[model samples]
Target chain A: DQQVKQNSPSLSVQEGRISILNCDYTNSMFDYFLWYKKYPAEGPTFLISISSIKDKNEDGRFTVFLNKSAKHLSLHIVPSQPGDSAVYFCAACLYNTDKLIFGTGTRLQVFP
Target chain B: GAGVSQSPSNKVTEKGKDVELRCDPISGHTALYWYRQRLGQGLEFLIYFQGNSAPDKSGLPSDRFSAERTGESVSTLTIQRTQQEDSAVYLCASSPPGIGNQPQHFGDGTRLSIL
Candidate 1:
């Protein structure tokens, strides 16, 4: 069973615009959520993360909002650049657990 | 030069053959993990190793699949008598020696294709 799901397979947005990618989870036990960006033939790089207790976390141009009651979270990239085009994966893990559950990933294309 | 490294970026082999994929994690990192992504699917956890402790083999799909790590360094994933369904990109990740909440660094991964 898929505990974490990113229903959107692809997204496109103009450069300098805000790009939003959404993710949903079925398990309520998940306490920590993270986002990773991956380029073609490259491994995923850590982006932003949020804890279950908080509703939002921001770092520079990337922000992650979490809604515990809804079992959902999203990543927003403001002023998106062409380099932001990549597959974004959302992952979750139970408190104190190292193994992460990942989503199917959303491919975002930022064009100028 | 300090990130996780995986060898043989791409490998193509016939069915019923055995293939070994290698991963060298970041230096001094005590935690290592293996995951795979099949076509149109999410990353699936395969195994985990931490320091000198016993590795977590819960995610291993079958007896034909096995992984080994020496000390806290290089890891090898061996698929015996590989099947067509075994084709996928196997990814390796590592983290520092601390709480599991830390983010993991990953390698480029080894893409294995069974012909």
Candidate 2:
């Protein structure tokens, strides 16, 4: 069973435009959510994360919003750049467990 | 300081053969993890090691799969009598002391192909 899901397989956007990626989770016990970006032949890199206590967190050009009632989270990038082209994965971790459940990932292509 | 490092970036072996994949976590990091990513699929947790504690092997698919870590520095995952279904990119990651809070630094991963 997929605990975390990213419905969109791919997303395309023009440079300097806002890019939004969405994710959903089935487990209510997950207290922490994270986003990772991956390039070809490289491991997933940490992007942004949100705790259950907070509804939103922002880091520079990236922001993550969490909705506990809907079991949803989103990552938004302002004025997305071509360097942002990569696969994005949403992951969740429970309070007691050390393992991370990852989504299928969404491939983002930022066209210059 | 360097991030995680994995060796033998790519390995191709025939069916029924055994293969060993290696990973070196960041210096002084106490937590290490292993994940597998099949083609067109999400990352699957395989195992986790923390300091001198017992490793978590619940995610391992079968008895043929096993892993070992030495001195909280390097880890080796061994797959015995590999099958085609076992082909995938095996990724390794390491984190600081906190669990479920700290971000994990990942290695480039070792791509194993069973022919």
Model 1 chain A worst lDDT run, 10 consecutive residues: A92-101
Query: On residues A40-110, what C-alpha lDDT tens digit does candidate 1 reach at each position?
Result: 89999999999898999999999999999899999999999999999999999876678899999999999
DockQ of each: 0.89, 0.89
How many Å off is the CA of A75 in candidate 2?
0.4
For candidate 2, the chain B TM-score comes to: 0.96
The CAPRI quality class of candidate 2 comes to high
Superposed model 1: Cα runs more than 4 Å off: none
Candidate 2 stretches greater than 4 Å from native: none
With a 3 Å backbone cut-off (N, CA, C), the pairs that clash in candidate 2 are none
Query: Each prediction's TM-score against the native?
Result: 0.98, 0.98
Q: Whole-model Cα lDDT per candidate? A: 0.95, 0.95
The positional error of residue A29 in candidate 2, measured at the CA in angstroms, is 0.6
